[model samples]
Target: MSANHRPREGRPAIFVTGAASGIGRACAELFARRGWFVGVYDVDTDGAQAIAATLGKDNAVAGAIDVSDADAWQRALAEFWVHSGERLDVLFNNAGILAPGSFEAVPLARHEAMLAVNVKGIINGCHCAFHYLQRSPGSRVINMASATAIYGQPELVTYSATKFAVRGFTEGLDLEWSKFGIRVSDIWPSFVKTRMAASFAQIASARALGIRLDPEDVAAAVWACAVAKPRFHKTHWTVGLQASLLAFATRIAPSALSRQVVRYLAR
Candidate 1:
């Protein structure tokens, strides 16, 4: 049976960053499938437009924004809120970059860029969308954290640190916004089979780990976080077995032991 598609007039709405591809695109599609209006925001306007088209004209809107820029985030959210009748039920800060090489091997410029997008981007999204979220009952913010955030990974040093920043930001804001009735949370997914993962496929140890998740799996978790009653109190949403296990291990194991486990996985 075909999924139930809601009419556009009275549906809830979500704004997703990095909606050009990968998990962001998947989340946009899924939200549209479930009858929510979607704002597909990405630096790649063409890619965002394509996804919006796929969701059908009535279901989606597209915008181009460099998340690293706070002003751009303001412009994007303003446009999105207008399209969504000034109602924003969710803000999925899913846009990020990963440099899957050794810290020293990756250039300084790339590390700076990663921090700008992966860390600053999320903060921009949260700040820009807070007013809209405060006005909308049950609204929430969902950031894209990573398994690497649990403990830093060697090859993905900068990227790992950025995810840690995201995790910390999500937790802090989740509490701060409680009085405003706006919830916040993040997803930690390990090795999703997206273009980003493909970029690192040549790494023997990553391949040896032999566990990969579909973008849709992470998308489903995003949806879960959005609609879960008691909302964002559960700030850590893990997307796969490995992600969940590692999250558990990090809590119980010593820091050295956890680092060893990550080293073993890399090997």
Candidate 2:
């Protein structure tokens, strides 16, 4: 790490993937303002650098990383460890992509891309950052999942599947990593007003529910997860009213009824 990148002693650190924009950027800003060192990593080098510059050198470090690439994840984490004083207080797996259209209309490659980033990316981050998190007391991993994970959505099949994977991974890991003092949690958010959401504005579900959440709304949930006291079973945090209602319905409603509700909204 460069002189400017050296960690500030006693400042908690967070490594946020996809920190160039959207929810990731919001989390970075919020964390930095709250006196945490931030690692801003994204595939967009310039954008990541811009965010770092905005946050100031002492407060943040920036790097380019394609979350789908395991080697890139390794390199980014290694560098982050240096700047964060070997601390990984929070690993925010917020980088993900989506393709909304008829399931068949979206190309297979795009679906695979979504899986690589949304699912594999979280796996890579959690697996690679294990030791750092183990060393830091009260470390937590936060994965960005979608409300679509509550039930499959028609136009968002692959993206929904990926979040379901994240949800499962977070649950399993939280149990497995408890011995290491690492808590794993995922955030479930309904559509947010971001460029990514804009791309799917025409989808029936988006048209019906509307994009009521903002990036900051989801970021606040992430912050909550970061500071929340550990619990035996609180592994999922829903970000919006829609997401909370959907999560509640899935728990109480019959499977057939839940399916019909999804169908009605997605129609």
Candidate 3:
């Protein structure tokens, strides 16, 4: 493996968005544990700094960034590059929100907020990180997509739509950035036991189905995607057994069958 593929002194670094709590926080901690300098960026500055503190002052840099704002993304990543010797090995667009309820029952503001943070967040992060990622050999982008990307859910319709947008962007960028030697990939994990998951009204189904995943599980997958070989670079990394099974089924199953399965799960 190239030195860039793993964390080394002042070289490999990862910046995680929404690093306050939940999956983003977990990703930042895992990368730090692996010896990578981590940037904890979030709208919640206190939460961001708390994560950085746990990682140790020398191991992490904390910044508050609202991912929907392109300018903020540029500024935060610029600082991150400076801290890591201008190197960026991975950019984890792990910040997102879940709004669960009937589409019309949810306020329009909530829908718009979801779009800004979940969809535009990925766009802003990838666009701003492009130059840094290009400079770092074997660099990768790991977007936090959900199983909802495979199909729409009534409760999380807006959130599902955002993930679909992320999945499309990951595929498009993977093709576009390959010439630049940057690997782009997305992850599809089922409901994880985070504050975000608990906020979902239909979260009980995951418990009923006995398929709730842990944040560390997805964190492990993020690390795997970060260092995966170019030849073995998977476009979509699915976490947990249910996600793995659904990924396989969706690829081979008919559209109608998958749609039916989605409806069943949302029940």
For residues 140-227, could you state the per-residue lDDT of candidate 2 as single tens digits? 8999998988998898899999999999998999899988888888999999987797787768988999999989999898998899
Q: For candidate 1, lDDT tens digit of each residue in 1-267? A: 111233356689999999989999999999999989999999999899888889887788888899999998888887777778778999999999987787778899999999999999988888888788988998899999998898887788898999999999999998999899888899999888888886676554467666489999999999999999882368899989988998999999999998788888787
lDDT agreement with native, every candidate? 0.87, 0.90, 0.85
- Which pairs of residues collide in model 2? none
Candidate 1's TM-score reads 0.94
lDDT tens digits, residue span 1-267, model 3: 001222246658988999989899998899888888998999998889888888887788888899999999988988888777778889999998877887899899999999999999999899888888988988899998998887777677898899999999999999999999999999999888898766655544454456578899999999888988788989998888887888789899999999888778767
Using lDDT as the measure, name the better of candidate 1 and candidate 3.
1
Which runs in model 1 stand beyond 4 Å of their true positions? 1-7, 202-205
Query: Which scores better on TM-score, 2 or 3?
Result: 2
Worst 10-residue stretch by lDDT in candidate 3? 1-10
The estimated TM-scores of all candidates read 0.94, 0.97, 0.93
Stretch of 10 with least lDDT, candidate 1:
1-10
RMSD list, candidates in order: 3.8, 1.4, 4.2
Error of 1 at 154 (Å): 0.8
Ranking by TM-score: 2, 1, 3
